[model samples]
Target: MALRGTNQEFGRPYNRRIVLESIRLHGPIARGDIARRVGLTVQTVSTIVRELEEHGYVLSVREEPRGRGLPPATLRINPEGGYAVGIHITPLGIDAALTNLSGDVIESAHREAPNATPDLAFDLIGAMVNDLTGLRPGGRVLGIGMALPGPFGVESMSFVGPTTMTGWKDVSLRERLAASTGLPAFFETDMAAAAMGERLYGLGTGYSEYYYLYFGVGLGGVMVHDGSALRGAWGNAGEIGHIPVVPGGEACPCGNRGCLERYLSLEARGRWSGSDADWVAEIGPVFRNAIAVVENLFDPETVILGGLASTDLLERLAGSATQLPNSVSARRDRASPRIIVGRGGQYAVLRGAAALAVSGVLSPRFGQMFTAERERGRDLLQGKGMAA
Candidate 1:
């Protein structure tokens, strides 16, 4: 129906944000309709629309006949007026993408991860951004959103396991990256970024709640509820890769035996190097078990298979996961299958990273703004947002 938590009492900034979001989501729609739907007064919507149009954020594309009155103008987001960058750091490599306000990829680049020491990686990132920006000068850039593999911000470097970026302990990513690139940067777990990407442009277009199983050099996952990630209290919500699947089977760097990824991840298969038939055999039971837990735990619309893993391989994994336990999502007339293989493929996390950048420009994050205000609004306060 109407948008969430919107009330007559909310101020101009809030109303303007809702107007902007409405135009982005449901435009070339009339301002009159936006006013009716978001419960804002016609004068308020008209003023917000005028402000947005003057700022190059919204454009009056066309007009619709209104029977006995002047035709109403239809407005939509101006794709070229703003741009965003998404960067995904993986054990295998780093991927970066530049996208317009509409989330369309304008350009992309990739570099091998082994070359990415703290200094080198920063330089590479700066160079990549320069290349993308230079392609078409004069486009306004929103900022960069970075997706990194975690257990992030831990003090003592782990002797072994997934938290293995060398020379990175105590090197604050947001602080360092911002200083190096001279752009506001936001960081998130790769899987969570992928989930947000899907939320904006992929499977999340249809499903509100789903599980993203990201198969990379390592395995990770994120559960999406509503349109945002379910970031736990400390922001370390999704780490399903370390879940013990083959109990007492293999030693894991996360200090567990038989972690699910140990048996079913692509890296594990690569290290072992078996035939596809042998590979299928090795991954089946663990995948089935992981599905059982994932399906039962969240009762999401489906389990999305995504990340750096190839679609052919993900299909095999999805095929092998046939024995899903009974759940609320398994009802008759179910629109979604138990498993959905992602189409974004390798760029899923990168696209997700881009989505975060777009969100910073379009969505209202009062919670984040207030928290940054406590810090005197340094890098986090990209005042460029809320306006666009």
Candidate 2:
């Protein structure tokens, strides 16, 4: 399979990642099955599997058959192989959690940040990691994944554009976290991470194309196509928040008039309601407009309402959307895409981050061993090394 990044001199890491992803996606599969699935030979698969088993990332189960020459062995992911730490930083506070391979939260710590700031935020994250790692030493935390309120660059681990987050522009969050915790770090914008979480374990299950609208202090968007995020040029593909909806309504932080976020975000609703059923009545129109935009543009398989928004609010908005007249010309018997509420809600982003981090560690591509093995394999094929 084609690798996504620059070719590494050591290729074992890539192979490891491939093998791990195969097992994670299709476990209880035999070594021969894994080889066929990953496009690797049986010998290569066995080598990688043995190394994975030795490293505690894979476990084997013996299968007894009614009539068989020998019992076949099935391979599965070791849920306890390693742990991933995920954090979601919102305006109100920071939510930190640790999850295993199965995406089960083993420990969680919430820190209230009455006065949110970059310095305080980083400190809170460090403290949370320390707390969770201490609580589950046996889990061997591999790294940290942060879901922040901003736009993350697709090619890099930095914020892409202006964000509602204070003092977050051009911040090297990954480096800061690695320095603070002495562990590898990965980062994603809150919306994209939430979308990932939903795709893997929430309302997005079985849907290849969908949109996850993150309604928080600010509105954000995440688009998934073919089971992967569709990050546009400069990683700004999903900045639907800045999409002009009202034309000349309200001034937005992105220097636009009447951006979609100004009309539909939680903060906007709070202002509209003046604390009168603030969560529900205020966001109703915004949700309607958002649904209309999604339908006109992507017509996705489903549009998931998530982020910090409440499910009750989502249900109300979904009901309201259905009442709107279809704008499509000569509409036929095609079913309208369902507007569903997400399971993780506010915690979705953090959980998605945890999932990415865990996937990175448990699989071989994220580890050093996999890269080395691939490099050696290439060298041997090139006749640079003598065959045994």
Candidate 1 stretches with Cα past 4 Å from truth are 1-15, 36-39, 63-71, 153-167, 325-329, 366-388
Overall lDDT per candidate, in order of appearance: 0.74, 0.71
Taking all chains together, the TM-score of candidate 1 against the true structure is: 0.87
User: Using TM-score as the measure, which candidate wins?
Assistant: 1
* Prediction 1 global C-alpha lDDT: 0.74
What TM-score, computed on C-alpha atoms, does each candidate reach? 0.87, 0.84
Q: Tell me, what's the RMSD of every candidate?
A: 3.9, 5.5
* Candidate number of the best lDDT: 1
lDDT of 2 by residue, 67-136 (tens): 8576779899888877789988877688988887767788888998843677888887888898888877
Q: After superposition, how far is residue 213 of candidate 2 from its true place, in Å?
A: 1.1
